[model samples]
Target: MAGIIGRNVNGNIAYLTALEPALPGFITNDHKFRANDGAYTEVIHTNAGLLGYVSDLGHVDFYPNGGTDMPGCDSAECDHARSYYYLGESLISGGFTGRRCATYVGAMTGNCVLWGNLNMGGLVPKTGSSGIFYLETNAAPPFSRG
Candidate 1:
């Protein structure tokens, strides 16, 4: 489920942007925001593997390397290999007076800021104020629809 998801001049796995949440010269994480109830979360990936989880509000917690058994997960006795992360709260802020993707900001501290009329990869807001969002292996169009 990892490595070489695409091919370009050579190979393309992930693309990191020079946004706030990312390190100076590296893209080391993947993110997804749930807007149904307004939640933003990300999975921390490292050279070793999935390091742990962090939220937009300012809560950080990591998992220790262990066997497949997770101790205080739930009644199902969760598996360490199969874990889930959640957002703590909404820390979205900026002078941006435009419609933001998902919850507006990157959802995590230092994360990038993507602004436009659409969320980019998911549902258009119920207010019908967003535009058609698409994600492909090509350069995005240079037009904005309201």
Candidate 2:
């Protein structure tokens, strides 16, 4: 399955900085893995098991249309764009481990980088009779109007 998940960006700038191999088994299944432009956005996936979470390095930036060169907007007359960033982190317990990774970047004019942290937790793997079965959790935090 495919879908979009995350928060909406208003009028502000956002930036994300993450560490390498931040998480294990982290992957981007689609191009919408991160918010582009200066509008509310989120990461998208084609699989149904990969779970996702908010990262301490996650962030968003909003800029007036024609103000920034962000990827989410294209019209020169537009007035705003939203930016998003994701980081890799794990929240598994009981010997089971999971990690997260983020992708994407946007640079828009008149846009300032806003700093924020996102902490997400969920089941990235499934248990079966044979043992521990691992699947992409693609988990995301509950959607908000931020």
Candidate 3:
């Protein structure tokens, strides 16, 4: 964390942020990260694929497919490329809504209930709130389910 910069970003930041793990080069669930000093974090993950859970960082975490192993994907490269796809679509359509989860387990298990919702990535930072979120997307394009 410190090597990337002169300080620990996982410690001090204030604003909305988003993360998507496209490759093993990005990170895996085994590594834990948290913005301990009032920074809101958002993690967009495709369940537990080759690029598994990134972290339960002290921010808004989104779990797609409930962290279940996704099927029809056989290449780590393709798995790595998907985050870009989602982000590209997200920027234009501005969909990909998520439901607040009661617990991290609830997000991982796709057991999110009828809590409030938030749009994942948007032109503006999703400020003033944070929580674990769950959303479903198509395995292919038109990925934003709103």
Candidate 4:
């Protein structure tokens, strides 16, 4: 585990280290770091000096005011099961362009807007299949409902 060795303000030797991924873009399961392995986990810093997660399907999930979990859900709930919002295949082709985003099943909440396509952890009635969902927050209004 190679890492950068440096000293803190107090002059004591300190180590600033993070694990490097074995492969490029092959990371999974960790939320505090960039999944790209070589890349440092990036964050969006607010004017108020708050650090927020960036929107990356493989990296991290962004919620309103930079929050990560949807409010009012239980740990056993399927919605909070994952850290990142599940981007359905071909659901968002061009990526989030407006202020608001939506999901088919998972539960999330944040400062931006959101649209729910189906109940969290529920099967999609039209397809009869279970789905995962997560969406980043934006400053625009929601584009769809349900």
TM-score of each: 0.19, 0.17, 0.70, 0.23
Tens digits of per-residue lDDT, candidate 3, 1-146, equal: 32222124544555433344333554543334444433445566654545554445545777765644433446655554455566678788875888889886888777888569987775555656678888787877787777
For candidate 3, the 10 contiguous residues with the lowest summed lDDT are 1-10
On lDDT, the candidate that comes out on top is 3
True-structure RMSD, every candidate? 16.2, 18.7, 4.2, 15.8
Which of the predicted structures, 1 or 3, would earn the higher lDDT when compared with the native? Answer: 3
10 residues in a row with least lDDT, candidate 2:
126-135
TM-score top scorer? 3
* lDDT per residue (tens digit) for residues 12-55 in model 4: 22211121112223334333343232222211111111122223
* Candidate 1 lDDT over residue span 94-126, tens digit each: 111222224312321213234553222122212
Which sections of candidate 3 miss by over 4 Å?
1-18, 21-33, 36-39, 47-50, 68-72
Clashes of 3: 2
List the global CA lDDT of all models.
0.21, 0.22, 0.60, 0.25
Model 3 CA lDDT for position 64 = 66
Better of 1 and 3 by TM-score: 3
The residue pairs found clashing in candidate 3 are 41-60, 47-67
Q: Go through the candidates in order and give the clash count of each.
A: 4, 34, 2, 6
